[model samples]
Target chain A: MNMHKYEKWWMLFGSGTLLIFLIVVGVSAFYMGSTPPYCATTLDPENVREHDSFQELGLKQLDDNEYSLTILASAFDYDVGNPEKVIEIPKGASVSIYATTTDVIHGFEIAGTNANMMLEPGYVSTNRYTFKNAGEYTLLCNEYCGVGHHLMAATIKVVE
Target chain B: MSKVEQREQTTDPHEDVDLKGTLFGVAIVGFFILFSWFGVWALFLSR
Candidate 1:
């Protein structure tokens, strides 16, 4: 009988790598589902800041009745997109969003929070998000047009 | 047929294999699957 060379090595290496990846993914999925996704934006004062918990999207209590945020995207580079900068609307009122790219097409999406919107070059897309309960939401650039696409990310804070 | 020709026909030399193509195809497929899975997870899950 002829023995197979490197068969065991290939099998073990492939299966091991796949198993590790799946395990990491399984853990992350559970954690993400447990915690409400936080919304982040590029218009942050500091580079990064953390919010205690989820609040309403837009409210006057945070000291502003309305807010306007402008972001720039050129070719493949993009300015930051901060969800906290997105005004938190009052309990019953709506928070308006006006977003556009400077050069290329990009999508602005808030995952799991009904904040799905898009942004295009030279044109602003405006939408409103209303929140009754307080929770953190995640904001992400849902478009892939460049090398730094993965690095384009931020969060939105909704505080009561 | 000559005796030498009959002996050469009966003996085996080696198996021909397209290792480079097999490796390249496997690498491309594996990378695509791995990155796509990671990209989706990072995009959707990393909140």
Candidate 2:
């Protein structure tokens, strides 16, 4: 049978479908790279302190103010796997995080929060986020470093 | 009676194998499939 009669229909459908797919991929790529909302807080894994040294770390204050946080991952703690600690910040503030590995390779990823900043083993990966609401946010190690990778995690608290 | 022989014939090889047209058709179909996949994923599934 001659394919002339059906050629127009085929071309129309084919071209239309192609156009739609191109549009979808373009839009999806745009949305995928977007950062989630979170308050601005700077974190330095190299200088982070425990809850006891809140003032020494310059993180002691409920003044609804914005402050930067510095964290340091030692070789033992970095190697030992355990629950990730959390940091507290105020809502509607911006946060900047810088993380790097000290000993072996480790992963850092925030849980229940829009912070998708990735932490590299030796290299520092920086990411900024703004907190729109007040709540508890946990930091999770996305990549497995070694036997203790499972215990590599932390949290960040957001208050009013 | 004398013995007789019969021969079978086939259509033109070129006519049966449309290399250029087939390639074009495949390319068009592929583009369409990819286009639809992205469109649906972003417009509906992403939401």
lDDT tens digits, residues B1-47, model 2?
88786665454344454456755676677667776766755543322
Model 2 chain A worst lDDT run, 10 consecutive residues: A50-59
Considering the two chains of model 2, state its CAPRI-style docking category: incorrect
Q: Proportion of native contacts found in each model? A: 0.00, 0.05
Mind giving the per-residue lDDT tens digits that candidate 1 earns over A1-160? 3223333445565797699797886775685333222323333222112221111222333334544333444444434443334533344334555455554567677677555666665444665555545666655678875787766655455667
Best prediction by DockQ: 1
- Give the poorly placed runs of model 1, Cα more than 4 Å off: A1-93, B1-47
Per-residue lDDT of candidate 2, residues A11-77 (tens digit): 6767877676667567646865544333243444344442232223313343355544544444434
> Cα-based RMSD of the predictions, in order?
13.4, 10.8
Per-residue lDDT tens digits for candidate 1, residues B1-47, read: 66664444443222244345655566677778778978876755432
Docking class of 1: incorrect
Overall local distance difference test of candidate 2 = 0.54
Error of 2 at B46 (Å): 11
Angstrom error at residue A160, model 1: 1.7
Show model 2 residue runs off by greater than 4 Å: A1-67, A74-84, B1-47
